[model samples]
Target chain A: MTPETARRKMTGTWSAHSPLTDVPAAVDTELAAFFRARHADYDDIDPVVADAVGALELFVTGGGKRLRPVFAWAGLRAALEGGGGSLTAPTGPGDVLRAVSSLEFIQACALIHDDIIDQSDTRRGRPTTHRRFSALHSERGWTGDPARYGESQAILVGDLSFSWADDMFADSGVDAAALTRARQPWRKMRTEVIAGQMLDIALENSGSEDPGAALKVDVYKTAAYTVERPLHLGAALGDADARTVSLLRKVGREIGVAFQLEDDHLGVFGDPAVTGKESGDDLRSGKRTWLLMCALDRADRSDPAAASRLRTGIGAVETDAEIDELRQIIVDSGAAEQNSARVRELTSDAVDTLRSCHLASPFVDELVALAEQLTERRS
Target chain B: MTPETARRKMTGTWSAHSPLTDVPAAVDTELAAFFRARHADYDDIDPVVADAVGALELFVTGGGKRLRPVFAWAGLRAALEGGGGSLTAPTGPGDVLRAVSSLEFIQACALIHDDIIDQSDTRRGRPTTHRRFSALHSERGWTGDPARYGESQAILVGDLSFSWADDMFADSGVDAAALTRARQPWRKMRTEVIAGQMLDIALENSGSEDPGAALKVDVYKTAAYTVERPLHLGAALGDADARTVSLLRKVGREIGVAFQLEDDHLGVFGDPAVTGKESGDDLRSGKRTWLLMCALDRADRSDPAAASRLRTGIGAVETDAEIDELRQIIVDSGAAEQNSARVRELTSDAVDTLRSCHLASPFVDELVALAEQLTERRS
Candidate 1:
């Protein structure tokens, strides 16, 4: 079979209506090749260094939705739809794939650092990097505090991933001119994401009862980073016009926020088996997410005691019963309904924007389908 | 005075013999302008993020030897001397200065993360970034574990510095073509440094009694990162030919290793007034330095009991008396003398290499003087 036909065959086996089609497989293939090359390089370094590289490779390849790269590829395809003959097509598929796949390294950096911040024990049903390294210390009966050793190693590993991201992006085999075009959005994405993460940490500590505050965090930390900026990077690489880039940004922001809202909902309410995360994980961590903020807002209006409980419960060590009670308050206070309504509204807005863009037919259809999958998924 | 004459004047009065002269000030000026711009951007984002940015700015500006940037500038100057007019001069002094100054940010990233791993309380006579952030958590009475919060914030701060380093280096006003030339060494420096850091962490935990292991870590972690790669990067930016770059790399490696050996001596034996660090701090932290390794090896030969004691004492929590005992073993075993001799040999070898390179007169003289200062300094 031809490459395109083989790709279709691989993706076709997924559920009949999946919008991602061959994108996830293609991205994974790119990432796998990238890691294989890196592993070879590290193997020549030393066993210990090689082990650190292996950990990073495992974390990056183990499990992820490949959402950012998917969005980037979709953006590239959408931009190519318009007959702007002035803008040259990307020289080869390999370059575009390499460029987009670099997003996974950025994501790995964020997740590794985030796990440390959240003191998370597991990610994607596996030990977090810090925890894994901590276990290594224990297994070896090494000197010093095992916990500190693990955390330190994880920090270095995360840093290596950050450096590798830039290296891979710059070396992505894209022409120099196209790489230059992609740099601005890449830089912006990095700065904004870190700033957004800082805001998340600060707000979680502040215990502020402001929904807008949480939404701002979502916009900066999630919306721009998870979707909008990646799309912009792809559009830039594709040499899209300013107007098209702006339009893609709008659609991406709406969908990205909607995606995160769904995540918040699932964090507290979704089945552990389905979500692959413990129920109420966010509530336990006291993450200042919009869903929790909406619940607190409703609690203040009608149930001061519930609001007070939430205020005290946040960032506090909580029992299973307390977690359930917090979940109950969110559902009982109409906050859950409000959050769901917002998700629907944002997702619809995103679809409408995409429709108005008059992008190429099948790719636009895929984007709209992807939007629905993002906002309405159970896991 | 004219610009050239003004520069000469600035270099003329520095203790009559200091090799660095005005390079530190020039680098600091470039860094200050960069931070000023970043602080403005962060201030617009949020107060908390602004505070993080302020902390980073203070750390970068606070105090450092500026060795990496100095060496880079010296390399640039030396490369320019070989009138292989094929190699272009930098566009302007501003661009070259900015590019070199970006090295400071990389140093900051390393120090911040190193401080966290070592659980260091102070840096440059101020609370380290993690400690400072921890204090903020406690002062604000924020809920949850304050130490973890502090460490998490510091991790993000370090990551931000890493990102800013790349961003600043890219926007350093260097011509794009020249910047491209520099990217490979820049990338190599990042990867090697982190790999070296990993090796350091691993060896420290392994309880391995191998001096070779410690030296290996020093070569990767300190030597190449602190000197060789920066010199290579500067030479690349100057568009030096392969031979010139390789020659500089050898000089850099020798001097870098010697510099770290001196640092190892200073960490244990230097006066607090001069070093700004408590004596025996390395012993207390159980750092597996070359000095300590030499002491262990000598102890094995002449005093097995002392060797056993040193092994047991290395990673143990130590009181003042215990630290003193550890320090005595290192000195009494003649490890201190051995380490010093190694430093002398390496420094002499480095100077000999520089002598043979036939670099431009004044710049080569400065490099030789710098090598002596690095190896002979008490602090």
Candidate 2:
């Protein structure tokens, strides 16, 4: 199965040939059951705890691309099918689904905490966890500052999400040895993502404008957890050889970078309705993304005045016209084109690597399809 | 050893007869090594990440009772010594130390987040994590709101602490089966502590006058993670039988409640130099502690005027004189006496349960000593 065939297959309903065809639905089902059981347990403990879990359930089950879990599933399938034999301690599909779905809770923790850090009011066109909790405090006319109340609760909610993710993985019923093996990448992913966040804060705070610094953050903050480690975790769980895991990690890193590059493009150029976020938000917030970094670098060398204007506009411009001017600078400097080209190059490299590795049929094809979808999507 | 002998031994340097004599130092050593390894790894990733880990290392290794790890260690020793013989997969002392030391990171998470929630300036007479980070931002002349920047970084630090804790536990070198058994109570403890925090926030916000509500928070927020579940985790790690675990939990719960009750007394009466907290902070902050609830209830019946004054002063009083007045009201209403009496009764009951359980001699003695220290400490 080539990329073209894989693309065509994805365009239509997934057939039996696609091993991960039911993954998204299956993950949803598992998460729903998990939350339902958690709700009952929390209620047994205290109404307040139950309410916090309810908020988390609403936020988690609300919306997500389920990309991490899908990648993990694909990694497992590739490892198992490519190995030419079942592992001594095999992971059944049910256990795989449960284990992979746990990633979403980790994602939940990331997003919940991210919103508080960014002081973001909305996520996916809905109030973020902190905002929603804040509103609840206000609506109930609770004593003390409502904002503080909201943030504190959201903090606890985020902590609970993390704890739940660990619990779910531990209870996934995978054999102890497999679970032990899986935990290696899982632990690394946890530490890297968190350290990535700290690095981001420090970078932004220091106002460092180096494109290299921005890319370094992308490697840890987005690439590792988003793609590489999830795949490594899956491969480990399947008892894949270290060589195979290493190859998958290489592919995953490339795809993860490409995926984030695409997101950077969307943050600047995509339609708000499609992206569920205002275009040029990265510029407005001065996020120092790779695209912005490239624009600044290129502008500094060739268009000094434009570079000056971009610097002045970022994190200061509020009006649409001002934002539009900054966007024009990014485009006129050829940074936008470069960003898109990099995404394509990275994605192609990732697909080529996956193909050359000779992973089992259909699993390799599915991974190629995923890489294309992630790096090529408009939103 | 009986409580009397246990108390006397605790007053002296621990002897060889004491099984858990070296627990605190052993835990400190393990944690120091863990942090050093983490620092090197974080440095390999990036300087910013390394700095963040450095801050966490300082904060975690700074100061605390190491009570949770000590209790967990005692629990393990009791189970191993009392169970007649080792299970097929016995945990070595080294593995046990590594696993138990991970609790301090969890404690770090709780304290760091608690400071953020409380908007506290200092913890243990040093600037809190958020304050420390905020000061760093200000010193660096960083962009954006310094206070928000501080909080955002602290939130990430708290998250990193939690991830580090889970990672440490996973890499604790414990037998896989033991890790699996330990995770049950570990999972419950994590959830309960976070949920307990939410409950405390909600109860405080709602101005709930019920002593039962305060007790509920104690059961989840402090008691469960701080004592009962740590003991349970140790027992599980030691592969103790179900009946022994149950008995330990029973004893733990009683001691835990007694411990919190004593903390309540100290909150209002202990010296600031000793407790490292301003006396009557619980009253000043309007924490719905059991002591406050009892005082409010007794005052409402005996002296409605005093009750009205207490309500008005709570959370509003700032001066030493004002806090002193509130303290007087509590003592006059007999709440303080009742609180002390409850602590004594609970501690006695816990010791009785421990004696009746017939656990191996010195482990039980160490536990009894620990219970007395915790419940009777000035701090």
Candidate 3:
């Protein structure tokens, strides 16, 4: 097993009852149909928008498991049953589905723009939209650089996705009150995430940024929005009260932070094949990740070599040895172990919340187990 | 006045009226304070966003008529006058003021993104965000082309503006129903414009595009969203009934078309200084405008020179003689006069709608005047 996965301290409460195995099948079916329906009107006029719609369909279908949406669904379904959502009928499955898709769309937009913003050529082992369009631009001999055109088009496509998401959610048949409830967290998740993204840009650009600041950015930017809030959003929609909702929020916040810490751990010292990404790319890109920041804070500036490597190793495409050395510094400074504890603490807290959530369904056991696996699984 | 202005037709029974001058001052006071308060949190966070906030403040301060929000406020005040709004209440002004600001924020985001996407170097004679950032990017010696980076950052900045608009709307004092009504049209406007932008790109690239097809694209893309929708949207929130709304839609569509046709005329044949643009810029850029399209449809195959000029003139920096010749070709070909009649007819249709509308307010008169000026004004 890779050392990155081995370091996790997973103590999941999920037993054998979780339905996560069924998630992928459901997500794929809905995605395909949703895409086809959204694109049906493309030919009415503006073939360029049609072209963009085509591009969106192609990109969304390319890769990545629909993990978040499924989790949201599970959380919501569990909430409904616990509250006898049958009798209340506050909202329906359609609204939940629409919300989940909106989240997925949001994820898609983020990834597309992130790819351009980061200038990565490949995503999921395939050419990114920018690269694909850049080649097309060159072949077509369009004005300016194809890469620039690609970036421009990709930016617009992401915006289209974002706007469409709002449209879809607004048009959904979910009980208005329930939809409103779900919307509260959904909106917060987006705002917090965007703010986090801005912070990320700031962290990378500023030389003064270090581990503590990076950690806070990670929580707001990645963890809370990615894992915790999706869970909290689902639970809230299912009518989880203030107390239970509060527990979920705390649980989500803790786990979300821990999850990103794990992601940070993997980024620097991971196997390319297993991770489907190059090891140390993050360090090379000079991301002000929590680990790098921590190492920077702890490093002895008296050693000019270490400081130079840490600062320059990021963003260098060819300095493999320097990247390895930086990884060593991260480990040596004990950031990895500290983050591991953070993960464990968060997982335990989440389990503690579940234990008191008044869950009657067997899915609760699965969620508990899945939460443990998220932090503990050796990938 | 040009023949176009003299021939300006009535659009609907919806007559144009001068906007109440008092509205702009009220809008300015509230918007300035609202923006300042929102950015008041910036002292503790990244100063870049704070600076962006400041730039936005300056931008809105020097904005065009706060027509969209004014309409919204007018509608809300009109709607609530006899219904729910308490004119004597202490918080009434504050509440309505915030609602107007939310509308302003949406417009602000739209304009910012529009400038970046259009890649025009100036806005109201000032250098654009993309240009300012391009200069900054070049000075910083960052990776990638400076202009491209400038565009990228500007898009993100606009996105931040847009997301902030959503949050502001959510928290606005207007009722959820008002927000809901406003939200659908807002989304539609965004979609139509983006689609229109795509159509613009497609037409630019089309080797066989006709003038009629090109004009159709221009109409759908900018005219409807920018002019007509705002007027109707404002009324929708207040006293606009179904027939009134329908009538406004027809007026907006007709006036929108005329406005775009005029813009097309200006792009190809207008004075550089008056337009704050270069002459025949569209021709040099190979833009497929209505005038060129009309010329294409009417070009005499027997006159080899006319056809040749049409081809070579595209993308050519024309000389004064060439400009005169091209202008003659457009005028002599009957394209200008024909399209001018279209503008007149659209205005007539909008004026005609006034008779059909089920509701009437001062906004109808104000909207008509703006439409007439927008469609037929020389500069």
For every candidate, C-alpha RMSD to the true structure in Å: 4.1, 4.7, 7.6
- The prediction achieving the highest DockQ against the true structure is 2
lDDT of 2 at A238: 77
Native contact recovery (fnat) for each candidate is 0.82, 0.92, 0.30
Which model scores highest in TM-score? Answer: 2
Q: Write the per-residue lDDT of candidate 2 for residues A17-107, one digit (tens) a residue.
A: 2356567666777798899888877778877777789999998898677888888877777678774323454546577668888999999
Q: Give the per-residue lDDT digits (tens) of candidate 2, residues B1-379.
A: 3454345434753322335656666566678889888876677888777767888998998967788887787667767777432434455666777888899999999999999999988887789899988998899888778888889888889999998899889888888888888888999899989988998999888878999999988888888989999988888888888878888788888888889989888888889889878777777777778999999999999998998999888888888999999999999999999999999999999898887776876677778988999999988
Count clashes in each candidate, considering only residues at least 3 apart in sequence or on different chains: 0, 0, 28
TM-score of chain A of each: 0.91, 0.93, 0.87
lDDT of 1 by residue, B1-379 (tens): 2354346546643221224456787677678889888887768888888889999998999967899888877667666766131234446655766888899988899999999998888877799999999999999988667788788889999999999999888878777787788888898899999999988988878887788889989898988998999888878877777888888899899899999999988888888889877767788777888888889889999999988899888767468788888888888999999999999999999898777776766777888998899999988
How good is chain A of candidate 1, measured by TM-score?
0.91
CAPRI-wise, candidate 1 is medium
DockQ metric for all predictions: 0.72, 0.79, 0.31
Per-residue lDDT of candidate 3, residues B162-191 (tens digit): 666666655656565655666656766667
Interface RMSD of each: 1.0, 1.0, 3.2
